[model samples]
Every structure is written in C-alpha cells, then in structure tokens.
Target: CIWALVITLLGYVLCSALNPKASLQYTFTPGHPFATGVEIDYLEPIEWLPQSHDQDRTLGAFWKYLAIVLSFAAARDWLMGASRQERRSGDGASRFPGDRMQWLLWTLAINAAAVSLVGMLQRLDGTQQLLWTFTNHINGGHGAFGPFPYRSSGAQYLNLMWPVTMGFWWVLRRRNVARRSTSHRSGGDPHVLLLVLAALTAAGVVVANSRGGFLLLVGLLVAVFVLMMLWSKRQVGFKLGVLAAMLAVLGVGGWLGGEALMARFRSEDIGSMSGRKLIYEDAARMAEDFAVLGSGAETFAPLYYFYRKKDPAWNGYVHDDYLETRITFGTVGFVIILLIFLAVWLVPFVGNGIPAPPEFFLLIGVAMVGILIHAKFDLPFQIYSIHHQFVLLCAVLTSLKWQRG
Candidate 1:
C-alpha cells in the first residue's frame, strides 16, 4: 500500500514539474462557460447523475485523479489487510511503516535543504522571476521557493515534514529508553537532525512570508508544545524542562525576526483576512446554487466568476478549502467528505493497533489534524507537493499499526 502511494507520489511530482500551478485556462469572465478543453468526461455515468468533473487534464489534473485512486486503494488495503503479526506488535514497532517513515523523512529533509537554499538565493537577489516557469503570477509573488512557485504551498509542504520527524523522534526515543543500551539494538536519536531540518523549514516559511502559513506554523508550535507537555510519558520535571527550552527557542526566533513577522501581520488592513471572507461569501452563494450536485470538480474558477461580486478582480482559488469543497461538490459531496475525515481521524483510537505507548498514536493523530486545520484557512491542496503529500499521509495514517496495549 505504501509502495502504491509512493509511486503515485512520484507520478504527481513529475507531472507537477512538467506542468506547475495547472489552473491557467480556468481564468474566464463572469457568465462565461466553464473551460472543458480536454473534456474527457472520464467516468460519466459511474458517478452521480448530476456530479461534475474536471475542466481540463492540462495541468496536474491527471495527477490528482491518479493520486486519489491509488491512495484510496492503498487505504482500503491497509484497513482490510491487517495481519496477526501487526495486531500483536503492541510495541508500535511496525517494520514496514517504521523504515518507510525514516526514508521519507530523510528524503524530505534533503528537499527542505534544497528549497531553503533556492529561497535564500532568490531572496538575496530580490528576483521572483528566477523560478518564473514553476509559478503563476499569483503564487510567484514574493519569491518562488523550491518546487512550488507559491510561498503558501512551500510553507505547507515544509510544515507537513514537521510531524514525520517529531513522531519518529518520540517513537525512537521511547524505544531506546525502554530497551537496554548494551543490547546494541540502536534506536538512535533524530532530535538534533530533525530539529535542524524543522528550523530550516520554518525559516523557509518565514522567508516565503505567507500569512496563513506563518499563522499555521505558530499554531503548530503551540500545539506540539502542549501535546508534549500534557501527553508525553516523560517525568514531570523532564516535561517542564522541555517547555522551558521550547520557550527559549521561540523567544530567540521572535527576537531575531520580530520586525518582519510583525510586518506581515500589520500589513493587513483592519478586519481583512486577505479577502478570504469575501471569497467565502461568494462560495456560499455558489454552494446554494448547486446545493445537491456541484458546480463541478475543477469548475470553481470559471463558475466562481459567474457567482462573484462585480468589483475586485480576483482570478484564483476561493482560499478556504472547506468552503471551496462545499461549493465545488455541493451538500452531498460535502457530507461525504466530512464523514471520510471523521472515519480516518478515529482510526487510531477506535480499532487501531494497541499503541505501545498510547500517546505515540496520538502524536501521529495530531499530525493529521494539523493538516486538516491548515486546510480550513488556505488551499494547501492546490499546491503541487502538498496535494500528493496529503494523500500519502492519509494512507500512512490509515495503515499505521494498532494493538491491544
């Protein structure tokens, strides 16, 4: 299942490299018909009678569908393919996922370094056009960071890496502490490397200067801190010490970049959240228009204009993912989407393998929740890397080992 997910991941990455942003032709005037360039109508009667489909397969569209199919297939396999070995592995040391997690973490760490380097060069040179081919004007604003042309996508991609490293760090640390040191069964510490990687990713987020990304990062830090403080199996004194250390790290980061961070928040106008609320308002009307069936899957851009207000020339995503999904898929689709999320979120606790230390499962659960929270404020799904990354993470979460403690 993981292999299937990874293959699809590579497929998306290559597809995205070939065609970035992928929504160019969706730009159209109000009352204009939705673009249906490649118009295959891939799976017509197979879907609901009135359900809509993609506008074109030009930009990363195929990747989206392919990734979804593979991911869901993997998820299905994971849920039904549970083995006796897995059920009894209450120590939370599932070989497949554990090895796969380490490999993916290192791969992401390398990617982070490359992205940070590119972003640094772009920032130093003050040239957003260096990575022009990879980004659209909308995402190409401040600086094109790494694979993504948009700062928000880059930040979100980097943000997702945090949980992978942190989860393993906790798992390995527990394993090491539980076993004898002289046993020579090494479950070495990933803290120093993962921490450095996280710092670099956070710096990239700051350098990208995405308001929502910045907010999400801050929220993530707090969430992780609170989780560690409250849920960690470490002694109380150790937990307090961890808290003090994290506070100092935050204080230093704020002190170093206080002005620029403040500027991002201050640059906004009063009561204005990047005009997202306005988009949501428009999306609400669209959701009503197509209450049962949706406007279409990727039809939001063209369909949005028709439902949009006269002023403010905006030609991009609705920004809010839930609202966007609601508007795109309508009420029925929205309900189904909500149910799927709830089902996955409950996997760890409901019937998942008995966690070695229960909180370990909770850590992974938090990672999933973080993305869901991030999705509410911005279009992380639109970003190339993050879109597929979410699919892969979903598969991982679904297949994770659960046991009777």
Candidate 2:
C-alpha cells in the first residue's frame, strides 16, 4: 500500500510536469509493439516552460519517482509471497496465495496514508495560496480549487476516489447480505448503516462540483437501480429515492452557496474550455502525419513547443485518455491499453451468473464511470496516485469470486 501510494503521487507529479496543453499528442513512441509503421523521436529539452504556477509540470517528476518505488515494493512482495506459498505447497505458484485480497487491502491502506501525507505537505508549504491565483481563471470561479499549484486537478482526483471507496464498501455489504440472508439474523442495522453511509458518499460526490464526477455517479445509480428493480430486490427503490434526495440536497446547497451546479457548464469560453478544440485539432493532425509508430514516448512536449505557431501554452498531454493513448502508443498500444480497462470493467459481468449482485455491478460500474469521467477533462492515468487506485480497484474486485474453495 505504501508503495502503491508513492507510485500514485509520483505519477501525478511526472505527468503534471509535462506540457499539459500537449497532453494528448505526446504518448506515441517508436520501435515498440505499437510502433509498427510509425516514426519516432526522443525526449528533447524545452525552451520556455509554463510559468503559471498552476500550469507547471514539476509534479510529474514526483509522480514518476513514486511509481518507481512502488514497482519495487510490488516486485519484492510478489517474490516473498511466492516463496512462502512454495513452503506450504509445491503448486503454490499455480494456486491462490494466502488472502491475496487482504494483502492488497493492506496496500490500499498505505495509499490512503501516503496521500494524506502529501496533502498535508502541500498545506504546510502554502502551495494552495499560489495555486489559487489560477482559480479565478479556471471553471468560472465556482469550483472548489485546492490550496496547491494544481488545485482543481488535485481536488478532482481526490474527490473521484471517494466514490471508488464507497462503492467498494457497498460491495462488501452486499456480499455480507448474501451470506446471511438465509439465516434471517436481522442484520438489519448494519445494512441500514451501509445505506446511510452510501447516501452521504453520494452527497459528497455531488458537492465535488465536478460535472463529470456528478454525471458519472448519476448514471451509475440509475443503472444500479434499474438492475435492482428488474431483480425484484426489496426496498432498493426506496434506497434509490434516498440517493436522489442526497443529490437534491447537494444541488440546493450548491445553489445557495452561489456555486450552482450549472456554473461549470456555463463556461462557453473556448480558452476556458482548456482550449480543447485547438489542442485536439493539433493532436489529430500530428498523429496522422506520423501514423504507425508515434513521434516517440514523451516526445510531444518539445515537438509541440517547436511547431506551435500560436498557442505558446502547448503542453505534452492531449487531456483526453483515449486520445492520449492513441497519440502516445499509436494504434497497437492504444488498443491494448483500452482492453485493460475494458477487461477490468467487463469481466465481472461476463463470468458472474444471471441476477448478479448489485454490489458487483455497482463497484465496477461506478469505477469505470469515474475513470471515463476523469478521462475526458483530465489525464489521470499518467498520475501515480490515480493509477494506484486503478490497481487497487482491480485487487478489491477480486473479492467477488463466487466461492473460496
């Protein structure tokens, strides 16, 4: 977990250091599996970096370092686990190791601890004061910008994780309910508590003020409720109504605070939209020019700086995950990367029988929704903390296996 968190933070730091404007066009590299028919370039130096404290990519280096450290820890743990299992059973390599999910949960706990530490570090150094200067320029002043140089991005990242955690808890409660339903032990209070907590979590989701996150949650809940109704689950309709109430409360609160939910959408300013059209146009044009193999891994920032005629703010990333993957990994790398996410999201539904547990679908559903949501407005996979959550979600979902034996 400690390692995972480090990876997560460092990944964010590294990604943020690159040209954010060029975010989508920068990922393709030459000579790898995806490099077929593609040309490549190596990483080059930049002449002028973005001076807007909020736009600087120094954090990208931090994220890169964190990912390296966590990778080491995961490798070490895998080896040790393999050794221990071998002592107990010769086929340990082929069999499930002792409490794989528990070990992963330990890693996740580490991630939470590490993130809290980083959050504290930012607070102590007064990074928020510096980052807030950009807040006036971002999202129409209605968003909750953090105290860092990358306030909005950081806050959005953290807020998205809240739902992922809550969804996991929902899965846990559901599994317990399934196991105990036959006994009629009146495990009612705990179930009630779970619903209450889930409601509060849904409320937090809304207060995030991120249209992407809010919409993702709404879509997820709708799907979950529909499935529940179809399955004839008792009281699920009421539970969904409560969830609706939570959203209403958040909307009303946002309005009263003068930060209405629609504020994010009202930013019709092309520049305010992060200059997305220009960025996307440039990325698409460049990718086609260098089709097959990409310019190279992490080479887009310098190229963008060189070729850019108007937008001096060009960063390496393209902002959208699908586009980033496409430009970075080319077609082959793009497909494989997408398959990873698809497999993670869809496997549970495929293998699980009819009338799947609400928890099973909801966890995967909300998580994918969060990933897809975050993907559109920001490039999170490049961030270590966000990536850590991805891996942790995969580990947590393993618990849904139908039988221990």
Task: Quote the lDDT for 377 in model 2.
Answer: 71
Off by over 4 Å in 2: 1-127, 130-163, 175-206, 236-245, 248-261, 270-272, 310-312, 342-358, 398-405
Clashing pairs in 1: 352-402, 353-402, 353-403, 354-402, 354-403
Q: Model 1's lDDT to the true fold?
A: 0.58
TM-score of each: 0.73, 0.58
What overall lDDT goes with each candidate model? 0.58, 0.47
Best by lDDT: 1
Query: What is candidate 1's lDDT per residue for 1-405, written digit by digit as tens?
Result: 334434543443333233222232334456544343221323323233334444342234545756675766665465444356556664644453344445655776667656755765576566666453433444325546555666677777767766555655566555655664543233235544555555555566666666776677778778777787776665664466445545544554455445666786887552667677777777778878777755555567765655678326444687778777776556665665566556655665565542445555665566567777788988887665677676666655665545444
Which digits, one per residue and each the tens of the lDDT, describe model 2 over residues 59-93? Answer: 44444545545554464345234345456767533
RMSD of each: 7.7, 11.0
Which whole-number lDDT from 0 to 100 does residue 266 have in model 2?
A: 71
lDDT at position 293, candidate 2:
36
